[model samples]
Target: MTLIHPAEDLGVLRFITAGSVDDGKSTLIGRLLYDSKAVLSDQLSALARAKHKRTAGEDIDLALLTDGLEAEREQGITIDVAYRYFATAKRKFIIADTPGHEQYTRNMVTGASTAHAAIILIDATRVSEVDGRTELLAQTKRHSAIVKLLALPHVIVAINKMDLVDYSEARFDAIRAAYLALAQRLGLQSVRFVPVSALKGDNIVTASERMPWYQDEPLLDVLESLPVGEVSGSAAELRFPVQLVARQDGSHADDFRGYMGRVEAGAISVGQALRVLPAGHRATVAEIIGPRGELAHAHAGQCVTVRLAEDVDISRGDILVAAEATVEPARKLSADLCWFDHEPLSSQRKYILKQTTANVFARVGSVDSVLDVGTLSHGQHKGTLEMNDIGAVQISLQKALVCDTYEQHPATGAFVLIDEATHHTVAAGMIRAFTA
Candidate 1:
């Protein structure tokens, strides 16, 4: 079976699909891959003979392409996050097909954490006008809230199953207006709406003649044209988390004492002044060694070993920043925590907080508030967090950590909590403020 991968020279776009259960997200993605000719003949043949075909005879069930698990196929639902890759002539794309159930909210959050955009599908039949007001599903609000929390650069609201509604323009308009209101409330920027029928392949890869009133670029065009801002190599602040320290023969005339890591944010060059974080020791960059040997300069996303003019004490988990930057080492943090484990979070339990290359013991000092997805509001916390619950909390750490707010630099601002006993990841956190 041959697999098709995107060309190396083309720009890549990574996005995730989210919606309520049975909202046709899998079908939309399957149709996208199929129409783009990413599927191979052997895979198509297997799909044709598959026993869990949902479509009528001789017509393949495109959704089967994404719902790969035995149980998912039988249940006609997506449970885990599924990733698919395809490319058009213009751009390469990575699509994360995330689960839609409320119970799988954690899975959706995991899928969206690294995505540049999110395609939120809204089932047409499930929404309607009541008392001169348009009402949407709870899952729709829940997923949208998560997208806002993640600060995804773009949002594409795909009103799916348009064919089922006879492609009504008024129905689409009402849903669009209601969604716009929700987006404004959640502070979601760069939101675009499109009406589509994933099953019938209308307005997915090409323009749909059926919806002549809807005059805009199709879904694929919107995706190809969306600005993927600062993917890498941008002028953002410098943040280098030391993953390893390379050393060689100290007694030798030409000794090596280099700090090795990926440049998470801005650029770095030889002779540039740098300050070692948590220690506040200052040094100057002397050399940078890339995969191809010596490099005079390096930017974000480039992994290299850097030699310092003065070798101050440095180790793994130490951060290097600009000399003039203001950073404080704090033992307490105000953060937004998303609980992902089956076991509820207890304030008395201790977990290892893993951020960038640093790992430190941490415990929940207080659960301040819990997010109400239904209302898009924060309510008083009940003192503990269940699975898929998000809340604002104060965390106390065993050691001081130097970092930035999530809105400023996501690399150093985000972290995950690991249960010390089981070594399982329990939650994801975003830093908001440093406290005493």
Candidate 2:
């Protein structure tokens, strides 16, 4: 397989596909790869073999292409995020096909976190059918809200299984209206509704002739045209978290030491003044170093080492920021957390909080509320947060942390909660506020 470097191609777009069970998310992705001619011959042969093993007269199970795990195959459901890569002439794509079951909501969040766009699939036949037993509509609304909260720029609503509804425009319109209402409520800005039949490959790579009422671009066209570069531009505040301290000793010449890290936000230039946070010390950038040589400027997403003229106390977890930018350092934080582990999160329970290469001891200070996804309500909870549950919690860190709200800077505002005993990540959290 050829490796396509993301930096070399600025048109690479990372997106996630999410929906409730049987919405044809897996099949839609399979069709995309197949229609785009990204699937290999050997992989196609394997798929054919898997098809022959299935019961006769059944459609080729496209879900087989992504359900790689033994457990997933046996259960016939995607359990984790399955990453797939493809490229068109216009753009290269990396897609995270996440599970749709309620139990795997955390997996969906993980897949959607880094995605610039999201494709939400909905079965057309089930558009208006109310399911009070399962609260299907409520679940869909919750998924939409979470995706919006992550600040995804574009959302494509794929009304799949159009063939099952006999290509009814009314059905498609009804589903589109429901989604639009929910999107408006959640403050989503960009949304596109597409009617598709993944089984027959309609309105996927090419527009479907059966649906004459719809005139928008095909799904692939939308994917190819969406902007993939930096969304906020260079106006945001400069943020660089120290990842490693590099020191080189030269016997014949001079000794050099620098702080190395990826620029998490904004831009920086040589000789620009900066401040070391948590320590509140000031320094000047003596040199901006890269792989080739010194650089005059650096922007978000670039990995570089910076040498300061005056060496102040600097270490991993310390943040270097533009001197004029204001930052707050605190020991207590309020966060929106998505529990991922099987074990429940309890108040006063200690865990390791990892943020931008720094790990600190932390304890759950308070459990504010647990989100009831089905009711779209916040339930007052004082106990444990189970798997796939979203809740608000207060954490007390062992040391002061330099941070920003998740909306301001994702790198400094996000963290993983690690189990102290097993060293396993239990939850992912977005810092909402800090208490002085």
Best by TM-score: 1
Give the Cα-based TM-score of candidate 1 against the true structure.
0.94
Off by over 4 Å in 2: 1-10, 51-60, 131-139, 231-236, 250-253
| Model 2 Cα lDDT, one tens digit per residue, 1-436 | 3455665554779999998877878889988988888888888777776733232444456677777787876776778999998887667899999998988988899899889899998888765556622123555766786786677889999999999889999888778877776677667988999999987889999999999899998898889888877633452388899999988884545678799999989888888889998899999999999989999988888899999988699999898888988786889999988888998886667899999878899998778988776555677584668887788888999998888889888888889999998998899899999976
lDDT of 1 by residue, 38-127 (tens): 899898988989999898888888998889899899999999999998877767789999999988888898999989999999999899
What lDDT would each prediction earn against the true structure? 0.89, 0.83
Show where candidate 1 strays beyond 4 Å: 1-10, 128-130, 231-236, 248-253
User: How well does model 1 score by local distance difference test?
Assistant: 0.89
For candidate 2, the TM-score is 0.91
TM-score of each: 0.94, 0.91
